[model samples]
Target: MLLKRLQPMMFQARRNYVELMFQVMGRALQAISDVDEPTREEVRALPEGFLFEMQVMPNGPKLIVEHTGDGKLHFHGDTAPRPVDLSIQFKHMAHAFLVLSFQEKTSVAFANDRMLVDGDVSYAVRMTRVLNRLESFILPKLVAQRAVKEYPADIHLPEKLMSSARIYLKVATQFVETVRA
Candidate 1:
C-alpha cells in the first residue's frame, strides 16, 4: 500500500525535474549555438526554417529551437510553433528524466525505444548532432561521457573549461531572467 502511494509522487517528481531540465537545456543550447561555430554549422545543415522540438508525449514539457533565416537557431521555451519540422517525443516522463539526467545516453535511449521521432528522421539525426555537441560543451568530461555517444575531439582542457564557464554563466543568467519574468 505504501509503495503504491509513493509511485505517483515519485513520477510527479521526475516530471518536474524533466520540466526544469528542458528549460535549462533550452537556454544552454541557445548559449552554445551563439558561441560554438560547429553547432551553428549543424543548424545550417538542417532545412531552412526548421523547427526542432523535444517533448514528452501526452502533454509534457517541451522546448523548441527553430533554424532561422539568418542561419542561426532561435530558442522557444515550451511552445512549439506551427509545423514542427522534426520532433523527438519521449514515451514518458521517466524516460525523459533518465535521458536528461544523463543516466542514459541519447543513442542508448533511442535504441532502447524510449522515444518517437515525428517528421524527417534525417533531420532528427542532424539535431541529435547538435544535442551531442551542446552536451559535450556544457557537461564535465566524465559526465559528458555518459550523455554523448562520442566525447568531443580536439578539446583542450583549459579552453573547454573556460568555454564551459562562459556557457554556464549564460544559462544561469537566462534562468534568472526566466524566473523574474
Candidate 2:
C-alpha cells in the first residue's frame, strides 16, 4: 500500500531532480565556455545559431542549447525551440534519471540503447565532447568518474578544484537569479 502511494511521488521527485540537473548543466556549460579555452573551442565547433536539445521522452525535463552567434552556448530552459539541429531523447524518465543523476554515464546509457538521438552525427560528437569537458570542470573527480566514461588523467587536482568551485558558484547564483525572476 505504501509502495503504491510512494511510486508516483518518487517519479515526480526524479523528474524534478532531472530538471534541476538540466538547469545546472546549462549554466555550467556557459560558465565553462567563458573560463575554459578548450570548452570554448568545443562550443565554437557548432555553427552559429545551431540548436540541440536533450530531453526525456513523452513528457519532459528538457534542456535546449543554441550556439549563439557570439560564439557561446545559450541554455533555453525547457522551452522548445524551432527546427532543432540535434536532439537526444531518453526512452523513459527513468533512463533520464539514471543518466542525469550520474548513476550511469551518458555513453554507457546510449550504448545500452536507453536513448535516441536525431541529427548530424558529427554535431552529436561535438556536443558529447563539450559535455565531457564541462563535466570535468563541474563535477568532482569521484562523481565525474561515474558520470563520465573516463575521468581525465591530465586534469590537475588543484586546477580542477578551482574550476569546480567557480562552476558551482556560477550555477548556484544563476539558480538564485532564476528563482528571483
Candidate 3:
C-alpha cells in the first residue's frame, strides 16, 4: 500500500501545533521582504489591537495571535471579540498547512475533500500567498531542525516493507514533480 512507506516517516512527524504556528508566523513575517516597504511597514505597524483568531477544528485548540502594530507577536485566548481583520480554519494538522503551501495539488486536495478552508475569500487568497512564500523558504530549515531534535538516529524497518516503501516514495515524488512542472 502507498501509505506503508509513509508510515515510517509518520512516526517521526512531531505535530506540535504551537511550534507550527510560530514557524508559519515567523516565515510569513519574513515574507514581507517580498513586498514593498510601505506595505510591509503598514503590516508591521498594524494596531496593537489587531488580532487573528485561528479556530482549529476536530477538537484542536483555538488560539489568538495578537499583533502589536509595531511588529511584535503575542498570543492570548481569553480576549473578547476584537474585530479581527481575518480568521481562518483548517481541519488538518499544521504539517498539512506546510504541505498545501508547497504543493499546487492542495487545491485539488481540497476539491477531492482532503482539506477544508473557511473564512474571507480575499483574505484567504492573500494568506495562501503568504503561506506559499513561507513554506518555500522556511520549511526546509524547520524540517531539518525537527529531524535532528525528534529523530537523530536511523530507524530500522523490515526489509521487504522498506523496499516497498521506497517504491512508494519514488512514485509519490514523481507524481509531485510532474504536478509541479
RMSD of each: 1.4, 1.4, 16.1
- Measured on C-alpha atoms, candidate 1 has an lDDT of 0.86
lDDT of each: 0.86, 0.84, 0.45
- Backbone clashes in model 1, listed as residue pairs: none
Candidate 3 per-residue C-alpha lDDT over 60-149 given as tens digits, one digit per residue, 9 for 90 to 100:
445555565554434454243666666655565553444434442344445556555555656555444433433333345444333222
Q: Give lDDT: candidate 2, residue 90.
A: 95
Query: 1-181, model 2: which lDDT tens digit per residue?
Result: 9999999999999999988888888888777776777777887878998988989887788888888855588778877567899998999999999988889999999999999989998998889888987887777778888988777777898888888888788778878888899
Predictions ranked by lDDT, top down?
A: 1, 2, 3
What TM-score does candidate 3 get on C-alpha atoms? 0.42
- Model 2 stretches astray by more than 4 angstroms: none
Model 1, position 152: C-alpha lDDT score: 77
Candidate 2, lDDT over the whole model:
0.84
Tell me how far the alpha carbon of residue 72 in candidate 1 is from the true structure, in angstroms, after superposition: 2.2
TM-scores vs. true structure, each candidate: 0.93, 0.93, 0.42
| lDDT (Cα, tens digit) per residue for candidate 1, span 125-164 | 8889888888887888899999999997877788788778
Question: What would the TM-score be for candidate 2 when compared with the true structure?
Answer: 0.93
